[model samples]
Target: MRGTPTLLGRPVPLGEVAWLTVVWLLLWGDLTVGNVLGGLLASSVVVWLLPLPTLDSGVRIHPVAALVFLVRFAADLVLSSFRVAFWALRLGTSPPVETVRVRLRTSSEVMTVLVTVALSALPGSLVLEAELEDRELVLHVLGIRGDVRATVQADVTRLEGAIVAAFGTPADREEIR
Candidate 1:
């Protein structure tokens, strides 16, 4: 009998442990210098001692793109809040419900997840799933009327573009296309 293959052929779950340590530090650490030092020591010790899986990644520091994303996110939140409030005030009327599939351009799992979460936070749309094989997203929308497909498509495009600008490399943009 052969054993099932694990991530990178290692049985160790390093990523999970690292994530747990980070969460613990964030949740339990006091906002004092002593506590900060203690937390850092604890986290460092745990990270150093644990046998973890390794994965490669990169980070980008794009100030202008980050600012643009933040501004758009805030604006969307405000707009969605008003739309929800309006719908709530109108009570008992039939809301136009529609299911729209958004085709995502970016293949990065993190970027795709971010887009899903952001869209779901908006008042009208909820992301049900991401079809990874086909790069499509299923969303349930409320009060969608007159060309919902185009609107959803446009929204997805804008989000992908913003994410690419903020965090993607030149290679990532090519992958998205």
Candidate 2:
């Protein structure tokens, strides 16, 4: 409802339609015309019955930026996977571990949430806590080879750049450091 709007005086339920289509596709496993028609009918009925939200503010996406974000995310995932594997294979020794605090550039809640989610998904890094009021994040990291502070800060900056590229409005060349 927050992200959607009403049509005329009533809400046009696109969410219900989408759900019905998915359920029908899953249950029937057939893409025949009759099945498609039935699914559409069911979806229409559900939408008519339910007070669904409308898409007033449509989604804005930048294709090139989205592609770049995906590429960087995949590469980071692979690198972090290898780092985690290497750390796991360490023989009878605990690596230097520390929690580093990183200050984020963008104060966007969406950007912050995305960064936290992506960092958590990566293997070698964990988000300990995020201080939204201060615009900082604490990360628990393993295998501190060099300056932990600098490394963590750089990592967070990279993540912030990726998020900005993906979601932020198009901008001129502005260094996010």
Candidate 3:
């Protein structure tokens, strides 16, 4: 499944084995055939049994873009964690955690769900609720730096863009801007 394989003319399963193998190596902190084989089997089985829904055929992932997205996400996750930690350090005078409604850049359900997952995966934000029809999420966020509403909305847009860059069509990338 190299070079962006698609299932039923839809994009999905973006190197599932590769992701799992990398995760396995990270967990084991060693590169070995046993570990690689183990990851391949485990990941393949899971995906085969419970696969993610395929994205529309128009969705196409550029390898470079996906790599860039992964790096950016890791950096964002670390930075957001630090920001949340700094906020936690503030004792009682902590800024209020605000709920903001942010519209997503992609209207596709899968893309929207991916954005939702990305937002909830971080510590600073949680998806309070999802309005699928409207392609919006009510997110509760920490660390209101300057403008609470705009800050949250911008962060959400950034997160969505990262995902779109990693696994979206050329059209998706254009629409995000």
Candidate 4:
């Protein structure tokens, strides 16, 4: 089933095994026959014992859009870092922090997870909660004095657009729009 090789009437998840093996090798920082064999054995055991739910993921990288996404992400990271630092160093009362909920454009599991991670990575904003069923995110944002909800929602929407443009299929992009 799933075009995977069967072992004793069960499908072997070769992709998961290979990915786990690679991770093991990277962690061990060695690439030898013994390591390879051990990784394979260990990964096979883990895959069989602790099976993960299969997901389509639906990720496809578009070079141009990916580059754009990376550039924008880097810029946001840097700018937000500085803004947080400035807020920290400033004298007087603390900046206002507000929690807001923003509805996302797409609700694909992969897309939702990516957006959540991106928002958390930025310095001034953190994803407090992700409601996948409702296609929404609850965020805690710092240093916003005016129209906090709108600003946070717009930022999340833009980030979601960039992510969809970079890795989403045509249908996925349409869902976001």
Candidate closest to the true structure, highest lDDT: 4
Q: Compose the digit string of candidate 4's lDDT tens values, residues 93-174.
A: 6978999999998968888888899999999999999999999999999987789999888888999999999998888899
Backbone clash numbers for all candidates listed: 0, 1, 0, 0
lDDT of 2 by residue, 1-177 (tens): 555445555554666777888798779998888888898778766676775444432223567877898899899889888877887898887867888999988766667788899888988789999998898999998776889999888887887787777666444114353
| TM-score to true structure, per model | 0.69, 0.77, 0.63, 0.72
lDDT of each: 0.73, 0.77, 0.79, 0.90
Q: List ranges where model 2 is wrong by over 4 Å.
A: 1-19, 29-32, 54-60, 169-177
Show pairs that collide, candidate 1.
none
Worst-scoring 10-residue span by lDDT in model 4: 1-10
Better structure of 1 and 3 per lDDT: 3
TM-score computed on alpha carbons, candidate 4: 0.72
Count backbone overlaps in model 4. 0
* lDDT (10s digit) by residue, model 3, range 35-136: 888977777666666777655565577799789878888987899898888878888876568889988868777678788888898888899999988888
The reply for model 3, stretches above 4 Å from the true place, is 1-59
Model 2, residue pairs in steric clash:
5-54
Candidate 4 lDDT score at position 113: 88
Q: Which regions of candidate 1 deviate over 4 angstroms?
A: 1-54, 57-61
